[model samples]
Target: MNRETLVNALLILGLLAAPFAADAMGEPFYVTLATRIAILALAATGLNIALGLGGLVSFGHAAFFGIGGYAAGILATHAFNAEPLLFGLPGTNQMVSIWLAAVAAAGMAALLIGLISLRTSGVYFIMITLAFAQMIYYFAISWPAYGGEDGLSIYVRNAFPGTNTMRPMSFFLIAAGLLLAGLAFFALLRNSRFGAALQAGRQNEIRLAAVGIAPFRIRLVAFVLSAMMTGVAGALFADLNRFVSPSMLSWHMSGELIVLIILGGVGRLAGPLAGAIVYVLFEFALGGVTEHWQLFLGLVLLCVVLFARGGVVGLLAGRARHG
Candidate 1:
């Protein structure tokens, strides 16, 4: 196998193994930590489709992330209370149904956001996307139905068919399995005709336009797909923590997703996973030792930007080989 493939395999296996090993050692905390890595990595993978593949640096992705979280929280809350939704629709504690709702809600929001944001480029695009995110963030804060700024909480994990999601390993497996599926989609999308068009537009919009391909359309579709992926992660995250809040919509969360991509190796299929691993481990290990842990995290990020521009996967597997 190629080095990149091997490295990718190792990364996936390492992630799956960490929690199992932790469970063996009676370290449920570490297993939970691994789940966080998986969910966050999946979110970043979504961002990578826009930022890395389509070359659209979106700063408001957290908007979709939060929307997905709220989808889960709101649905579960209604189900628990046995209340009907706005349309007299019954709330569901089913994970499958919740995921579909999250995807549909986030995708619709993305369609709206993309229609507006894709009109601008460079700094304007960045600012407008960030503006959209902040608008949602404030709306969440002011909207009292779901606990306003205090956030919404799910008293119990949602049901996932036959699996007992309350079990740490079961939940981790669910997250990890979704992450694997996301990665597979990434691979397939990257090698597809649509992916070629997206990347080509990123490289040269005028050329793509001359070839009768619309960059705007390609990007809008990609942006929507990206949002859907991240939205699923948000659902899983809410389930993981049993809580959803306005905090998920914060600009900081968006930036964290970007950092994960940069740390893992932007555009590389396994980059997000690698980035999430390092980022979470750093946070977990350093947070316990120092109050100013962010200072060190910043330093590490600086090093990555300055010295290892290709990121962790780049360092281990060398530059990615595009075929």
Candidate 2:
């Protein structure tokens, strides 16, 4: 196998072994840490679809991410209290239902946002997306129906079929499975004809259009898919934290998503995954060392932006030789 293949294999094996290793070592905290990294990586992977593949630098993905968290929170809350949703639909705590809701909500939101945002490019595109996310963030804060700024708690994590999800290791496996499926989709998309067109548009929109391809349509499709994936991650994040709040939709959250992509190595398949691991590790480590951990994170990010272009993957693998 080539270097990339070997790296992918090692990554998969490491993630698979992490929970068992932690359990055997009597260090449940590291298991939880690994789980958080996987989930964050999954979310960053979604952003990578648009930014890395399609070259659409969206600063509003946290809008969809928050939407997914809210979906899980709302349903779980009603189900916990034996309440019914609008139209008399009984609320459910089932994981499948939450996933569906997360995808649909994000897709619809993306459809609407993409329609308008596709008209612009460069700085306008970035600012427009950021504005939209901020709008959602403020809406969440102002609207008090589902606890609004206060947020809502999931007293019990929503259920999955045939598994004791409450167990950290068991839930970690479920998250790992979802992440692998997402990675498969990413690989498939990157190899498809449409992916080729999207990348072409990213590199040169005029040239792509000269070849009879519409950049707007391709990007919009990519944007929607990216949002859907981020939304799925948001749902998992809500379960992990046992709460959902407007903070998830904030502009800062969107910035962090972008930071993860850039920090890992833009356009590389493993960029976001590696970045998330580093980011979570930094957060965990820095939090233990200082109360103002974010200050240190900002400094580290500044250093990365100035000195390191390829992030951890770039540092480890050198330049990518493959297309």
Clashes of each: 0, 0
Tell how far residue 164 is off in model 2, in angstroms: 1.0
Best by lDDT: 1
TM-score of each: 0.99, 0.96
Question: What is the C-alpha RMSD, rounded to one decimal, of candidate 2?
Answer: 1.4
lDDT, candidate 2, 214-277, per-residue tens? 8999999999999999999999999988899999999888999998888888877778877887
Q: Per-residue CA lDDT of candidate 1, range 1-323, in tens?
A: 88899999999999999999999999999999999999999999999999999999999999999999999999999999999998899999999999999999999999999999999999999999999999999999999999999999999999998889999999999999999999999999999999999999888999999999989999999999999999999999999999999999999999999999999999999999999999999999998999788788888889999999889999999987666
Model 1 quality (TM-score): 0.99
lDDT of 2 at 153: 92
Q: How accurate is candidate 2 locally (lDDT)?
A: 0.88
The whole-model lDDT of each prediction reads: 0.95, 0.88
Every candidate's CA RMSD: 0.8, 1.4
- The count of residue-pair clashes in candidate 1 stands at 0
| TM-score of decoy 2 | 0.96
